[model samples]
Target chain A: MSERSPQRISRSALPYPYRADGLVFDVQAVLLDGEERVDVNVSRANRRWAFPTDDWERCRIVGTVELPSSVVDAVYPESERDSPPGSLYVTIRCRETIYRDRWMVQSETVEPKTYEVELELQRDGFRGEVELKPYLTRGAADQSTDDGSYASSTHARLASARPWTMLVDGEADADGETGLDVRVESFSTSPRLPKDGLYYLDMGDPSDPLIVVNGEHNRVVGVLQSEGSVGAEARMRDVVFDQIQYGVWSQLILHAGVAVDSTGRPQYDWQSTVLRIFARDLYGIDDIHAASRRLKRDLKDPTTVPEVMQRIDRVLQRYLRQREQLINLMEEGLRI
Target chain B: MSSGDVDTDDGRLADNTGTPLRTLTSEGRRLVDPAFLRGERTYADEVGQYVDEHTSDVHVELQGLRADLQAVVDSYDQYDSTIDAAAAPAVHRRLDISRRIAADPGVWHYLAVVEFPEFVRYRWEFNTETAMREKFLGAGTDIYSNALHRLWWIAELTHDGDDYSLTEEVLQKQTLANKIFDRWFARYRPAAVACCAKLVDESTEVAEEVTLRLNRVFSTRQLEGMDEAELGRLIQDLVTDIQNQGTTD
Candidate 1:
């Protein structure tokens, strides 16, 4: 690879769409005020960073994100109705990396019903795990919304009770494998996906084996729990079942937990929903109408490893033909 | 054929007649002032030694095709005077020279920029803004824009398997040549062949419309895995639509 730095062109200067071939990110900000979980769905999904040069190494990310209305309602003060509150502040952190400046919430709207509380950020960095945590300074408690309503002293949550969880939907790795891996689906994070690391898959079945990842030791140790005879084909089939469970169920859960970050649905909905349906059909899972809902309630309550894995098998059997066709397309799309 | 037997006399590269020639290094290619490329520095040794290292086997091949190239050059002034008449021989010479030698861009760059600096100067030799400099040096430049590279690529793209008749026909129409470089699909062998075979007898206007439509269609469609039959079907549909539109208008 050439040592040349990856060239970052503005969205306007792009020869092709940044979204079609650029890195896509969907950020979901979950505001937790004690047990009350207020989900703020924010999307900047349309922005794409295209590295046209061969041997691209890095690119600069420059974009703005608007905090959802739910976030504003969560932080608004009820005590003072006459005087508008000061600028609300929030800190967005991703894994170990944190932006130093607290993003101020501009309560005023340039247009009616469109309150602009946008965070303008510019960084030369790769997309990684991101977490947004909103903070209420002493001045922020007095801040007012555009309609000039003060927060009720009793109900206004001054600070984020817990870390805002960003749910990351999975992406197909066209450069390597086509579909998601079992470990990747389990550890899905928001903003950007982390490099594949260690994980544990506990099917919860007493007889089936457990897949465990020792992160510190950097190794995956599988323990066989079943004493019964297991054929080679049966074991291979088990592995495929685990992969489907991870790819379909885990991604479905993540999608349920978070909202898409783009202004509207992406043009390539076919790649996401249609293809995912096809994949699910391979395992005989046929809840197409339920899965289409933007937010799935089942994602909030955690399901056991055994149950999800079993669900994948059931779904794979439902739409065998479509699943095979999708797999063929994905295989053809694979370069290496 | 061996470069070992070739002379290192005064660090100069040589032609087939044992005349000392010039070659340029990769580094010299970047640092050589645009003014120098524009003929400000007329020193004989400017071409450098890279040419000698790479062109050992190509010496005889280049010699055989030299007369055909010179014929095209001789008729350069007659293009505007004769219109479509001058382009056929020129296209024929290009196909002949391009087929005779290896069509590596690096080799063509060396031949057009360094080996034949005098020829480059003679053609766009006096044009300002270092116009000839862009022709020799710009990376990812269309083969149509570069002096030697354009001729070779046109021949390579339009040739029908082993035959050069398709190449001659395509290049015979000046409008097609001008618009040909922009057709990204033409870079594909099957797509190029489909285009040549389909438009072999069409008028320049029809060819222009077809080329324009193909470019627009290719921009949005993921036509990578498409076979020649599929591409032929698509091209025929497009050509039919264009002819229908022309008649309707």
Candidate 2:
């Protein structure tokens, strides 16, 4: 299994030169693994720096760069003089590198290294550029003293590798006897971060489908484990969540091993899934764990169906009764 | 382009209130402010002070653009007498501005620099009125308002990466174009919007068919009864059928 390299550094340490007349300005460039590069600029005029198109033209680099394409991307030009502003920023993946000597060096004895370059310019002209030296220090490795319970990296890897899936348990014919008698036990919400551990389910049978329920905020609300290779899944965590303070929960259904229809769309019969009951602001870890355990136990127990359904209905009714309040909560969250 | 007799501060042109119009010029571009443009003060501010100090040939050129726009409206009316009369005036207003901006890049640059809230406000007002009166149909929708918004919405509703031609196709169909604006305020998901657009394109029966189906689907027990995954799949299926029909037939 391949693990993504962890590269975290501050803005100051990154390389780049900066110069300004009367306004403050800064620029940073990073060359990643000798395969990808990124350049960022921030200036007082626009307070945002963008990759200069003339630079690429002057550098005469070949292969496609990671700038937004004018054809597919629509932009309101700030001024006619600034044509094809390249991008407000750019991350160029290496089809090739111009500097052979400046390649990323790695060794068995050393942790991975990252190099950054920065430059700042004023209205007049070039200000300064800085080159960030690679940080060679490594953090402590996992030890036995750490918590015994660890997250499943297999699930994480799979989630990242196969981010989209179709739901099978939800697809079971509602009118047919084959439908699984699934019931909601308990429901709780948790804040999903930029990086969240993944949990995998093998439906035990290849014929059965996996069901995922996503919420409105794109959170994974529930997962229905069915029997099979119905390979539908979603990224357990989303990249967008990195910058957002408030998280959304989604009800998703994943069906495994589905093929695209003639129209380049997925073809799958998703099963019935419902968000019967929900609890809010249960921010404590213990509270969430307890709720999950309760739900799992109730789902396993056939006798809890009527009670679960009643509780779900009650919660939903309460929510509907407080629709205005819910809206206010959402608005408040947005303000935050 | 040159106003030799024009007073620097107080331009002679005055509104019905008898106050001289403020005038500003920068890089040979002239701006006359009956009302101040929003945002930070620039050369326009200096010109307003200049107008306050002097009162000659204040708004001769400013009035010229206004007259040019009115003339364009009159010409459009002459060209299409039977066109929606209520919409014609507003459409002409926008067309006049667009034409001027297209022809004289300096005016366009000045417009950009001034950052007048009134300009945007009036443009939006005209756009909304035209859209409402015309049943939300017209190529003018993209040309008259924020070009960025028009381009984005067109790209979004059209089939993936196929909007280059479909944009024109969508704009040409008055009924379909109207439907786009009608549903602009609807609370449907992003996927739902695409589905609706696809449905409109796939069928010749107009947007009513798809809209009616969507309404019925939402109102039925299916919407509340089905799980999220189920709803997504069903919607995807409908959209797929529509898209398939669009490409094939």
Candidate 3:
């Protein structure tokens, strides 16, 4: 009787993936292209986004798609029974919305006739926990589910089975969802750039702190983005990221300290938040008051400018744990 | 969620269209300057630089969408309710809705940068000045920020197959779209349409209250694993509850 309510249908009224005969995808194992075959956990499949750089390769999902003929008959209308009742196209779809590439190795129309699949995933920007499921699509071309049906896109999803998720663990540097937005930008266009260093932190946007990696020098976008991901360029990437973090922390702390000195506190909330979180995590400093106290006190010879750099270096040594991180950096070199 | 689009022509809109739908990484998204997004730079400006490192054979055509969007923005001076009502359906149809491609941050990034820079700039009010970075980059991930993506997603969620009535209703106010999208049921098409239907006609205060109540109900009642009968029953209960609140008021 409510005027606001529209024509209400029972929840089951609309066709909401309601199929009496649903198919299941039994993903057996994952194969590194032309190399090692890693058995899938059935629950979730995981392939590293981080391996070494030179040896990096694409991955493939190997599985069996099961659908009894009775299911095929029940779901699809008879060959002569209706108009263009499209074929059931089957494949594994990347359930991650953030991934750039969702193109699977293949998609196929599996009759009771065909069942096996060996689909490949293009190793471009593939990271994090990627959930893949054997999906049933209504239209588009056909082949074996994972084997021959590899395509970039598929049509209307007919049904979805229990999804299998995979965790591709990589280094900390490869994460994109961090508070600090680290980027690779060519500084040649930034005419007013004060420093043409390996990296520069653009602190203009008080809310969003940016770390611009100077592409003018090394142009190692891969090393920076990929880091320990599928292509493990571990040493150089780790050292670069470490140095960048150090610089960012030093500049921010210095800026916060200067702001507190002039006024009562840091000019921005982000400054306060970062000082509290990072300072606490990296150093033993707990509260903002303690941080404020620490920032005002200086290294020996407080009047001297280079002394600030000296203090930063001393803190960096502790944060980096001179022996630990540096040792990890050299472990790669020693391997070479 | 009903991806009814079939392949047309050389499969530009189809699943098999082997054209790579390019994307920019989160890091790459930061490199996108307001000037670059305002169509001041071409792909040669390295605006197309830092493309997601994918070897997928699929490629997407970076067609010019500036003139069309310029007309809309020039005429309306907004992501104005009027503009959204007209534009969402057009954009949805043009992109040839496929959830697989629709959900890719890279595809939206590519479109915003390589294909439709003006779309992002005009929508986010990039008038020779910087706008928020998330506005340019947050497609596919965030429900609200990305100008181009939210349009497609809005149209996708509300439109009954071949019907734009609900989409137009939701787009009647930007705030309403936010209310519908910011909920757990936003991804579920039926629930989204139901929520829009329930809220579209109510006063702003009443709608907001109902949505708040629904949010509380959703927190305790997970919608993910629920089937149609159960979800329908739950939604029906909310509708009755909303009617009672109307009576109370």
Candidate 4:
């Protein structure tokens, strides 16, 4: 069997030539749709961010990256600049494995001090993360023919910014399966925690948020795995578990804050542990760094209370109207 | 040029999200079903459901390639290897989409599993369940599988701008393409052209040996920095060596 040799990808691992000197190539994805810019609170700390496929539909990713002189030299030696052997270009590349799409969104053939990146990715057909890379392609004179050699050998990525990955999935409704899956499995079959545990995160692939429903918990599994049959018990069980799930939001907020970039985009780096953990308050909270800072409290100080936990309590109170549901249950009992 | 049905069972689709060029994502249901792979049926409406999603809307139009492929499948009564080679240029001609979109597996996945599955079944004949799945959904980045995708890509790699002479030669005659797919170096268009030019007339057995010899040569010498003439000379040297050695062997 022939090994898969994708012509698009360079075969060799490109080591940064100036790693010792700490020369960095950075590409920041500044969403360009809102008046000044988009204020979507996404975690980009891990150099990765996820948007509901539609959230990015109209948004253009704009960022600037400087091309160090040394890197330019790698593409063109001093002696050859007067009459260059090949045309050099800088381009923004978006790569998605799930759908297997890799193509240059933007390209600039003229060598400049910096390369500006811009493009809006289509939300259609693609359901996974798309890696954005800015690399230099030198179409050398020798291989510059009508033949497809340039597509194969023209790219010699001299030096570019660390790649930025754009994650596209709206894991909104747990029942709705698109970007991720919520599986029901028998955890009781294992030698672990309480045999009745309802749900646990299988963090094996941090890139994906897979919520494993413990099949041992009949009530939890039955409710979660059901299509449209929700009884009073299922509704009440959903309300109770909604608290556990809602309480998870505050932590995601904090993590999003700690891992954000200078532009305030959260750099969760691989810690998007629970993607479905969102709430009414989660949306429209533009400045996560500021919000997280206000909600933060030094745990080392014995006198200080983790203010985030308190905030979470308020969030939990409004979760599926827990207080309202509890009161209704109590009143029904008294009437009975 | 016609639009695909946009009404979706899932909310994944939107008003103005992407191009008409579709892809069958690995998410949710698969286009190829189990029974279909087992060759138990010719077609299955329950084969699969694809979400109505797309790359961003762009002004990309295709040249009725699917209809062309369907015609090819119609010509063949049963499994014949020549069908792919025969249909390749038609795929290459009509769907000369942006190399970027072409690189995407989803578009090909959509075609093979959704649009032209009959063609896929006719081409490979679902020899085995494992092989059938690969023909439908397997071969990540490998150009050897996915019946329709393999054909289109093979044509793309071998075709020049507005010229598919090389592409036709590779697919139609079964001359030099498959044997060269093994070497990573042949992905370079110049090298592929040079190698094909040198080995097209050789018999299958002789061509196979020469290709192996060429693969060894590429191991040391870089195809990236080298030009077409140099590649041609290098391949010519190997062919000459083979011709000279014919007397002894």
Candidate 5:
């Protein structure tokens, strides 16, 4: 047979570079002492993440998690088993070459650590549990070990210190899929603890640093950084901002371990509770204050309670009317 | 054609050539033609007029209602305006009904719909199609639609699939929608809905503080590293906590 040109083969099959699975962690923290604590709970049964590839570089992997009906009932007692909590699944596929060159670097080059955690209600009767584990990356298998590079320094610190773990039992299944079962704890040092409270978890590198923290209340459940070089202070600030306005700050306030006083009274300070709840419920405290100020200003006078109430009603009525008029105009304009 | 000249007595406009140029009224204007000068009246204009006319009436009614509310507030011995505001609507409605039980409170409910003043109207430009679309989708339209959407969205955004007690709290708050809902939703999206519900569940003081801080942070932080999904989750978490705290007592 005449020599024939070989057909060009495709280098990659997937659209995205990596895949990630997020698990819902039902984390409970119990403060054993001032400096030590224990956390325990079930991890998010379902995982969700995205992978990258060509054309549409990001691909999503999604799958349903079938927890034992009993577990479902325990976690969501009022929820019917017929309809389990639906989990979002995402996967990203990318070219093998892109995966080799880029995804590898993004996943690896960070250290792992463990932490001790605890929780106590300022009062009695409201108590909770805390759990700690190491957060690890599975995709990093082979890479040059150069400590001079920032990534390398952060990685080295992480590998050597093996600090506190933020993620627990994150691994891939037989099908080359990553699975994580983490207890969604109510507390994280990064978000709740003050900046000074963050110890090692806030050190080294400008992009990816090796920072670790041992909770003073729950020393065992420390938070560790496995990726990014930015200092823990700046990063913690960002995390704090994110958590308070748009992240887990709200969740913690709503579901935090509660306690009661010896006199059968709730021990949580009302003001603190209010602050926590506001941080959790409102995106930021500033917005609420602005609204309150606006409301107060609109009220004009506050001589008596009845007058104040009438003013409030008037304000609400006015507000609703303004909105209605706007909507009506929009509808009319659309028709035109 | 000649008969047209005689038809002039029949009240029709005719040209010098004796043929009708076009129909005209005694006022020398087109009788049947469309007038391009007719101006459009907006809801804002209507509402502004309504407010001006009823200002005194509203003030009087408010005065009476305030007296009744003061009595309730005295009984509770609570002085916070936020708390008093929450109790105002139900209290006002009750007092109004007590005056006229023979007539159901349903008719009075429509009074809540008011006109938009001109100054406020100028604050927003309704010139674009996108803006128009958003206006319709927002909770400011018809009472039934707005109320229904507000209630349902609050429930959807705030509820953790099962817990809706906070949603109830949100519905109870007068400022929840006006002072907090729109701005939060406009700036934050679906997350704001949940946040508003949480704010209601949480102590109003806390909610107020958080909203204030959030606004400040949003203005200062560039937030380049964070993605929208992450932000949504964060907001949801905050709202969830608020709900949890609301039930703690």
Candidate 6:
């Protein structure tokens, strides 16, 4: 097959000129290779805030697609291009630590694939996915009478829902169905831990959809939702383990940002471990910030997971000296 | 029509609160606190000018807009109907304001908690405290719940480019509008247009069924990849099935 259309590369770290705030990430791209290139500018129009709340930032993709060289040659053949020949189509994939969400502009038919395109995608800390795809119009050419005006682009969206199989690990509600199984109880909890059943371990928030199944020897095997905050997921892992009470080992799955493993488990990596460490301190403390108010007020509760993560990290910090090894272990197994 | 030159003393302005309200708030903490509204600071005549200048093309004053909104609230004792009518004008007026002003919760905080406290009081008489403190401050997508923000968003999602006839269609049925407002899929313009057309032609019961079925289809499939015509055809089939089911019922 023709070079499988260059699978879009996922950057471990955000490309340069991109910034990630608490819940927002911002990116920008300009024309890279086209006779007449379209300017792709992506940015969040709203302000950024923390997670668990509906503090979603509505980002936008805006740019112009000029008439392509082939089309210009075919139409005017020998005149200075005055008006935009067509509009740009944009698609953005916002990868988060808990889940990978995608937002794509309804694609437009673009003719000859010879145009160069560039874009900068920005989101808040909540959404880390940022890559822009732009192409010239293969669809009907612009009917604008004006010689050189630009066309309007579409809005950016945070993926509201994805294929459930894409996020959770379980037998499909159907024989082989996927997407959000809003009603599946495959991952759930009970008072008496069943010796041989799958259950969603009890995180502080029972409503969280992350799946935890009963593993061998009183342990629970579960994958964290890769789309959630690294800090939040780590905290959930810690809390779920503690709530299940002692003697039950917590085999937590980690992730590198939002990328997961083949079985839909969160991939463990050094970045996620470090992020979890930060979350433990910031959230583990007693009311340092307004966002941490609930953690402080409810610290005394049995379900209220406190910060023992840092203590554990310090111990591991001695042996797992290099971040690369820790990162690899996060993806592979680090049978300690 | 610069926002810095509105006439606060205009007879039409409502001075419901005896104390003056602050026009601009730069600090985050003070922005969320209700105490900021009760400070020594007073709203300058110029501060009031911002709304006038922003909404000049709309030609409606805050006092008039508030009264018109209150009238809708009064007539349609049903919450949904009242919201549909009341929110449309708010969205129309907001379209006239700068996005910079509308995007900031601080500006809206000043409008709901400070400048228009009486209107806020009128709208949510039973829970004014919660309404002013928590609801007024835009929090997440829930910020759309704010009195001003809610209307603007409802309009944003329902409107087709500059044509808001679709908004009017959605306003007639609470089920259709609520689904459109809350769900991201419904914000897809083609989908919204298709849903509104179906809802407008059907009964409330049929509309509900169509919306539910449509949502189920949307959540699973990638509606983003479908073009306008493709979305229209898909929604039309769903509407037809619901209609056939309704007839059998």
Q: Please, what is the TM-score per model?
A: 0.36, 0.22, 0.49, 0.48, 0.19, 0.43
Report the C-alpha lDDT of model 1 over A1-336, residue by residue, as the tens digit: 222212222234323211211111223322222121322332333221222222222222222233333333433433332333423344444221211224544432211122233343322211222344443322332234334333322112222322333322122232422233233233344212233534444322111213333333221222222232344433433444444445544544343223222111211222245335533343344544334332233323356445544554465554334465345434443321
- Identify the leading candidate in terms of TM-score: 3
Stretches of candidate 6 above 4 Å error? A1-88, A92-115, A118-336, B1-83, B98-101, B125-134, B160-163, B200-222, B227-229, B245-249
2 or 6, greater by TM-score: 6
Off by over 4 Å in 4: A1-180, A185-336, B1-19, B25-28, B42-49, B58-63, B74-77, B173-175, B209-219
lDDT of 5 by residue, A1-336 (tens): 211211111113211111111121222332232322232222232212111111221111111221233332322213223442222111111110001000111232212112222222221111111111111122221234322221111111111111122211122132411121122232353453345542332111111112233345342333222243344433433333232222222222222212211111121222133233232223223543343333333334445434434543343344234454444434443332
- From the highest TM-score down, the ranking of the candidates is 3, 4, 6, 1, 2, 5
- Model 3, A1-336: lDDT tens per residue? 332232222225224222322555566666666665454453343322333232345776677656545444543445511332223333222323333123232343445534676767654434444655544444332333323222212243444344455544332232222366667778878753555577788854433577888777764656666546322376666666777788787887676555443212443444565455444443355555555545555422367446656656677667656566567666654453
Off by over 4 Å in 2: A1-336, B1-168, B173-175, B178-249
Whichever of 1 and 6 has more DockQ, that candidate is 6
* Greater-lDDT candidate between 1 and 5: 1
How well does chain B match by TM-score in each candidate?
Answer: 0.68, 0.31, 0.72, 0.83, 0.30, 0.62
Scored against the true structure, residue A107 in model 6 reaches a CA lDDT of 41
Model 2: lDDT of residue B112: 30
- Alpha-carbon shift of residue A260 in model 2 (angstroms): 32
TM-score for chain A, candidates 1 onward in order: 0.30, 0.19, 0.39, 0.39, 0.17, 0.23
Cα error, candidate 1, residue A22 (Å): 18
Weakest ten-residue segment in model 1 chain B by summed lDDT: B78-87
Candidate 2's docking class is: incorrect
Complex DockQ, candidate 5: 0.01
lDDT against the true structure, each candidate: 0.41, 0.28, 0.54, 0.51, 0.28, 0.38
Cα DockQ of the candidate 4 complex: 0.04
lDDT-based ranking:
3, 4, 1, 6, 5, 2
Candidate 2, B88: how far from true, in Å? 16
